[model samples]
Target: MMNATEEFDPAVRSILDAAARRPVHERRVSVDGASLSGALAAADADGRVPLIAEVKPTSPTTAGTRTEDPVDLARAMVDGGAAALSVLTEPEHFGGSVENLERIRAAVDVPVLRKDFLLEPGHLDAVKADAALVIARFVDDVGEMVTAARERGFEPLVEVHSGAELETALDAGATLVGVNNRDLASLDVDLSTFERVAPGAPADVALVAESGIATPADARRMREAGADGLLVGSAIMAGEPREATEELVYA
Candidate 1:
């Protein structure tokens, strides 16, 4: 088991503490329980790797990435052919809020994922997004967390940074595996991280490459590395949303 004080980052601790304060039932946003897995799988049906566009306002590394309205940004992604959407709901570190997710969810029809350091089962109940992000390294029992997320009617995109973590996620029955190239410890992004780990992933799982994907070339490399989808934020948020997203989606 992870020592909460030692293993959990300050941002994670803050988020969890805030979650602990709110009643799960009160925080819950009602929505139709959509299948994020089906949306991800279907994106690659036409032979093009799907783009999971992120509505990130800020981050620990790059702050203030988005200046426009959240709803406008989401609509632009949809116009750009994004198969799904990822909304950063980690308020402190990411400058994100459930309000952003709630607004984006109402603006778009595609499945939306609430991206955050999900520590408690009540965290799943906190948002109405179709899916939720669960980092494997943070939780002691991966299987239980995965089961809990599913029980809340949310598809869990289990994220791992290395080969062992990938195996742990798969063994825990995670069908949606996200390989985050950015190392949480060093906060350094090595694009090769995904490439090195992709081959080890099972063919049956929906493999998603997360972080450091900037251009169409980067997207194509992840696709060639066997990624079924790309969870991109900064690059798409930097320029014209529709054009940048369209470029990556087609790449």
Candidate 2:
């Protein structure tokens, strides 16, 4: 577990503390057996950027709560042409649960990614998800977590925010990477973050731009900046999910 006294942002520290306190338990859920990389490849083949819409009810930064069922929200995103879905499973900071991941996985044919502050190999086994997120900054041994996720049949989506973190993810042999525009330490968003860090990645590695995306223009900018996909959450979840998703997908 991350030390609370470390230089982590207060919000991030709270989330990590909550994650550390979560009881490790086995979840009875089925995976969709979909490949996040494969979905992005398919979207590329079709000449369209893949959109990995997220199923987030609430966040540490966002206020209020979403009352809709995760499955229904996921279905709406798919209906609006989302290539895959990311379900937040961290309960405290992000109103998420493994049950929601399972329900969404069962409800959608596209790939489902488990988005959480995973700390150890044991955390990977607790949920049934097609893909898993391994934040490079959050784990002590990101390589081990990446290997564990692959061992459990999950396509790991390694997330990074800076050039150093990007190198750490690459050194860990992560093929799928997400460049987050939001700085977890300060909770500041700068869309240009992806533009600065993405060019450093190899061409073969699949890159997904995460956070700070709102409109079609934002999506287009990221796509042009070498993003293979976009992972959007708050923007889509704030309103009519289907319509909000369509605007980004068709854009």
> How much does candidate 1 score in TM-score?
0.89
- For all candidates in order, the CA lDDT equals 0.83, 0.89
On residues 1-251, what C-alpha lDDT tens digit does candidate 2 reach at each position?
23345686788888988887876656533444579989988977876569999999999788899988888999999998899999999888788999999888987889999999988878887878999999988888989998888877899999999999999999999999999999988899999999999999998899999999999999999999999999999999998999999999888
Candidate 2 runs further than 4 Å off: 1-5, 25-32
Off by over 4 Å in 1: 1-32, 63-65
True-structure lDDT of candidate 2: 0.89
When summed lDDT is taken over every stretch of 10 residues in candidate 1, the lowest stretch is: 22-31
- Give RMSD to native, each candidate: 2.5, 2.0
Error of 2 at 29 (Å): 9.9
